[model samples]
Target chain A: MKFNHRHVLSMEQFSAADIHAVLDTAENFLELNSREIKKVPTLRGRAVINFFFEPSTRTRTSFEIAGKRLSADMLNLSGSSSSVVKGESLVDTALTLRSMNPDIVVVRHSHAGAPHLMARHVGAHVINAGDGQHQHPTQGLLDLMTVRQRFGQIEGLKVAIVGDILHSRVARSDLIGFQKCGAEVWLCGPPTLLPPEFARFGARMTYNLEEALTGAHVIILLRVQAERMNSAFFPTAREYSQRYGLNSEKLKWARKDAVVMHPGPMNRGVEIDPSVADGAHSLILRQVENGVSVRAALMMMLLGGGDRPRGDA
Target chain B: MSAGVREPVQVMNRRDFGRALDRLAHEIVERNQGVENLALIGIRTGGAFLAERLQKQIGKIEGVKPLLGIIDITLYRDDFANGLSNPVMGPTEIDFSLAGKKVVLVDDVLFTGRTVRAAMDALMDHGRPTRVQLVVMCDRGHRELPIQPDYTGIVAQTTRSENVKVRMKELGEEDGVWIEPPRPRTLPVAVLPPPAKERSKRKK
Candidate 1:
């Protein structure tokens, strides 16, 4: 199982074996993360540039920590801070960064295929941090790692992803990733938020949140993309909370050992109840902690010769 | 010998392997002057198994168990950028501090000494040891780095290109040391493209 892809732009690019490689490598990094001196000299003398054209907290910090931990010289440039705000073309910016000879370029943009465009222009390996509503591959990977840590294996488990699937890059990536691992994926939200087209992706779609949560091993709550929504997707926040939001009452619909997850910057009252978010079943913080390990594994694969075939001794 | 395949010449049998380990374990204990504050850190895969066996052997002799740890040198390899294939990473478990302990770095086979260099650097990251000693079951002669094993079980002279395998029972192999000849390289079958004149004729 060679992780031959130089640039990780989507979960669609990952086969089951390739996903295993990432997860397996991340497992080692998870151990490294728990070390007293949580750092490795793997990517020494390598340069990494985190170019985020959108706002992020967890993703940016995770990538930064991962690079620093691997001993890679890291440079972070945000949309407001960089020349992207000055009307510099994406290709020109990428070319300029390429001239500086960064070994890895992590891109986060509001537009879809932005990282793909960056990869086309830059010689450095490109990792799509999050490209609009298209894909957040690393987040999907950490979620997989978190679930795998809890359950040991991903096969034959029901994963229910609730809320705003239409405006979520996480939804797209997780749907592909979980299904690839042989998990039955269920998408549940309001009709406007959950499209029937998602069913084409081999996920079971349900308007009733209770039905989706029923017999679920893992439940992932997506943040309502209020910023992306232009019109009313639901009657009100209160009504949506009562219908689709995962509170203590709705939690009973799932199995006794059912674990809950949320891609962070979560709407506490609107999307999930605070009690459930901080409950025993919640793996939200564990997912955040695994983010660094997963990103470190990605950097090691792309820059540390992890993806290449073994050369003769 | 078959085409592109090399046969291994067995140098040590299962009894020889056990005797070598028993001797190596005794030597490590004698050199360190008792097992107090002595920790054994093994390199991953083969070295890890050898370290475990040595730990038990030493415990039986000295009537006290030493602290044991395992270090994976895949991250610390200088050949990382040189396109060495991604080695499957195992957990590096150094739970105890190396601050005051006499660390015995154990390995199965010492060839390039590059692995030892990486292992030492990896060990330092955990904590600085009082003193570090190297121990190996087999020391096949090929030193890329200026590093030498302090306590060697067997020293074998071999060409740089030869492969020395230390098969262990723990890794699902019979205990033995074998010198394997390099595999014969197969000639690549070249595929010639059609001539330009033939291509022009095909267009008609």
Candidate 2:
């Protein structure tokens, strides 16, 4: 199949082959890391905009790195820093950016489907970094890539995703990604945080932390959104951590090869015990590192440089 | 089926294959300064196996283990809907850090560049890398996307009708390369010219 111009707004839009193409291209791009000159001129003449309506450190930085590596001129527009304070609507903001003739626009918004809406109005390729709790397709792919790299294959791997699944876009994206990549996904959290319909996606639901971790091949711990506590989902942070926290003792229930991962801004003592988060099995840092390569791959593909191979071959 | 033409199947032997991988490894190390702050990611199936081999060779030469990642670009392909009844996903492995690291993307062959496009989508969730370079065993040409291989072992010029097959001992039973000629399609035989007499009789 041929991909000329396309917008990536959701994980649902990807087919198995589509996913394979992105992964394969990223694999080839990874080779660039070993070079003395890390930057490539593939997307040098292209322009990219990082439109983030939500505050993010990891994601924003990753997209910036990806754009810079591809040699595309990058623009960072944050809601707080931009003219949104002057009363510009998202549609207007997107239209203004589109007028700038960008080759790609990476968006992170607080509203679900915001990227989808923006994509309809833009000539540039739109990449959804995160949208509310709906989906983070790129995050899902990178998480799957991380897990697969640790383990030879994802088939039949027992993966337990714990913490605030209710407000986690990462959880939702990882759920889809893990299941699609052949991993058995398990969702564990308080009843309020764990939706009843989660099982429909082929994931096993559990409220007990120990049981969820039992013999699991991979453990993905999502960051607990403290702001969501205002709704009385959990009584207190300490109480919540006691019931569902992944500590050293609980870590023993997972398989020997079991690895623990977290999407950053980690609450050291809340969602995961410090010992476990810093332990040898923790791939948390690895996740952060992979985020760059993955984002770079995404930008290259969306900007039309991904399809081209690098160097003087 | 095309007059006197025969389908071609040319083989690339083991010694030549090993040399190809060695050269790729050397190129990767020289480019990235001995694998420090570097990673190797492979496409699923053959690409992943090739990445592992390259990593092993690079590790021996560099004296430091390079992070190896495997990616399955199944959902990122362009022709996904036309191929399968149900999507078949492969594994993606990248245990090492990607942030601020130079990444080498390894694949068996570079053809239409569709696979590399998908692999890029899959790589983003992990983190961000300092850079991404593409390495392939064979550059078969005729790329649909603007993608170009950074480090290509061999540049084999092939027609659109030709098929390139890469076999590795880790994934396949043998290690070799084969080029096969495209098969021509036969036209459907006319059944009595659609019964012209019947059509005229019906008209009468």
* RMSD in Å for all candidates: 3.9, 11.0
Error of 1 at B155 (Å): 0.5
Model 1 lDDT tens row, B78-178: 87886655556778888888988899999989998999999999988888899999999899976988999999878877777678889999989899998
> Relative to the unseen true structure, what is the C-alpha lDDT of residue B91 in candidate 1, on a scale of 0 to 100?
81
lDDT of each: 0.89, 0.79
Q: Which stretches of candidate 2 lie over 4 Å from their true place?
A: A1-5, A305-313, B1-204
Candidate 1 lDDT, A95-172, residue by residue in tens = 898888888899999999999988888888899999998999999999999999999999999999999998899999
Scored by Cα lDDT, where does model 1 land? 0.89
Model 2 chain A scores worst on lDDT over the 10 consecutive residues at A304-313
Reference-based lDDT, residue A162, model 1: 93
Among all candidates shown, the one with the greatest DockQ: 1
lDDT of 2 by residue, A1-313 (tens): 4443367777777765566566655655665565444565556567888988899988999889878887778888898899988998888887788778877788999999998878877666788999998999888877877887888677789999999988898999888877776778889999999988888887899999888999999999988886875668898889888998889888999998899999888998998999999999999988877777777767655544342211111
Docking quality tier of model 2: incorrect
- In TM-score terms, candidate 1 sits at 0.94
